[model samples]
Target: MTTPHNPLCPTHHGGRCPAPAPATLLFLHGMGATARSWDPVVRRLPATAHTLAYDQRGHGHSAFGRRPPTGLAQLGDDLARVLTHPSDCFPGPMVLVGHSAGGIAIMHCAATHPHLFGTRVTGAALISTTAGRLDPTCGLRAPAGPALARLFLHLTRSRTPVSSLLLHLMTTTRWPLYGRTAPRPTRRACSAMIRSTPPATLDALLRRLSTHDGPALTALTRVPVLIAVGADDRLTPRPHSRALAQLLPHAHLVEVAGAGHVLPLEAPDLLAHHLRRLLPPE
Candidate 1:
């Protein structure tokens, strides 16, 4: 079934903004994250640039029907639908900002619809994302040790029962394991966000992440792209972001020193500073 035209707004909770048409920015959240995740960063954007942050299907307030497809192709279709909807509330040459999986979605969309880059999407920002897998041999490996790597793999491959247990462990006790490395406030915020996400959805998304190799880096080469990563991010790692920047001849790589996986939260001001420079004038 097609996603409903009246899909739940991503900011339905405490951040919803009901401004009129001409939204200058379309913000996409990563897997297991809702639009709320952008709250800290969006507030830092220029007030002139209206923002539309929303949850993807099967996550947040959006419909969770039949565990929506994980392919970036499907995500591209959804994005196109959102932008080309009959209502068409967004203005011309919008800036698409995505984090993690959301960044992957943007890259897929741009690659599939190359014309949208300069013609429609003025620019794109990919925060804490990778062009390919996290394999050590691939030269983009995270700092995750063998034990953590084994746990991650097991959690990804486990069935319902083991997966459920793993999810609880990660969400409850292990979440802080990652967050502790982030700024204290950012860590707390990210912890809450992670806890809010459903284990099943998280597991499903993680599985997709393992095999998700799309045209992100290749697509960014043709567009004005910004690739940012945290210096301390163990998930995507700084090296992956560097590799992605190298692949994109014109991409700007911003490394947030001392920041972790949740750079948006850890250094929202810094991120906003870069965003202001990259986004077109209103």
Candidate 2:
């Protein structure tokens, strides 16, 4: 159902005020990913579930303004703006689900705008993400880490066909991103998403993420939170989720076995179940 088109709702809806509705599920994707990353999880949710997944700045259809610095702070501000404006897709209370870099953005938003929690943001699910420090760790440390990082940055800065081809080749190899259980089709879809990311966006987000520090999120304590990580995730592994759980003492932490970094795609059923639990009774 859509809200009527009004100053509150615009021609997109046709009402002066946004219609009250069940809690909305706002899904945020990680770096180098788009709103489509949540497609699998959203498909598993109940038909009546009010859901909205949009490309964060610099990803998917969202334009990346070159003038502004792209980082967690900017992303957080963007999220705040979206929440502040109640539209047909974002009406009333919301349960936010963020993955990877997207989770960091959520934490930043919550930290800066604590007032939004418990009221506008009823709950949150952080999947395969960390508060900050996205560089190589024990779980993901490798001799090629630095080299890969450098290569990625270089590739993302260039818009040449060769650079794009290289990125496509690198992303098409699915072993590093998915667990043993993830189907081939899922990996292909993920690869496509990564390949489609604008080179400029990739470069900007990567540079910021490399130095990102975990955001202080005391505000999250005011609401139900689910901190989930994949046991096999090399990037932002269990330790990261544990730290998040510690930050929010009341959060429920779940480590899914045989899964990798892309929980929304690799384990949609599990994510869908937890998201539903966090939603307010309709």
Candidate 3:
């Protein structure tokens, strides 16, 4: 479907414009993160680039009234809406840039709606994410698995009040687990985003992450993709990124030494430099 001439503007101050109409760059943040997480990276982009970053449903400034769907495919749908919705602020070709869970969302969108990409999506950057869950071998175990499971069951089967209480605990209490290794500033930012999200959305989304098949690496062959990982990323290790890179026909893999999963904050300049190389000049 052709993207609308005008799209929904979710930012507090409408949307910022990139002078000279540079290619649109849509940034998707990791699970439990808000669009503000992209501030550092966005600031480094070429001044002429138009940009749009929104709280995905449950995350930032977006509507918290409805519970965000849990499945990755549903998240993909949300992304499609953002890109092609009639009232969306973004127009023309877009280069999708996603970090961690957001990267997975982008992959699902690209795979299911290849036509939407067309010539408009020049490339994609998947940072610190894997194609599938690593429950069995990744060594990073869910700390409160039992509590999480109980909360999930309650939310899915119980009343909104009970579920809401459980959700608050799950989202607020478990946020530290998600970014346990992130640096102090990054951790604070991530925590704030999670706290801002609705309990129902956080509960459902986390449950989805366990079973979500982010992207079938092999399916990315048609698009120009880049997979980068921190060499020391214990959560979604470097090996996972390597495995994903191997599946893409037109993919390039970059390993950032000593960098962890939070490369965007940990090494903004390095990440920006790579993005500059991947993005075409205006």
* lDDT of model 3 at position 161: 38
lDDT of 1 by residue, 72-181 (tens): 55666677667665443444556788888888888778777776666667778889887777742222245545656666666566664333544454355423224344
**Each candidate structure's count of clashing pairs:** 0, 7, 6
lDDT of 2 by residue, 1-282 (tens): 111111123222333333465687787888777777887888888867767667788677776765433677888877887788756545688888899888988999998998999899999988899887655432434666666666655554554333354465447665456776888888878888787877766666656666778877988999999999988887787888998898888999999999988899999999899888898787
Clashing pairs in 2: 4-14, 4-15, 5-13, 5-14, 5-15, 6-15, 6-16
Best-first order by lDDT: 2, 1, 3
By lDDT, the better pick of 2 and 3 is 2
Highest TM-score model number: 2
In order of appearance, the predictions have TM-scores of: 0.81, 0.83, 0.76
Candidate 2 has an lDDT of 0.75
Error of 3 at 20 (Å): 4.7
Question: Residue 140 in model 1: shift from native, Å?
Answer: 14
Give the clashing pairs for model 1.
Answer: none
Off by over 4 Å in 2: 1-19, 66-69, 137-170
- Model 3 residue 32 lDDT score: 64
- What candidate 1 gets wrong by more than 4 Å, as runs, is 1-23, 69-73, 135-144, 158-183
Worst 10 residues of 1 by lDDT: 1-10
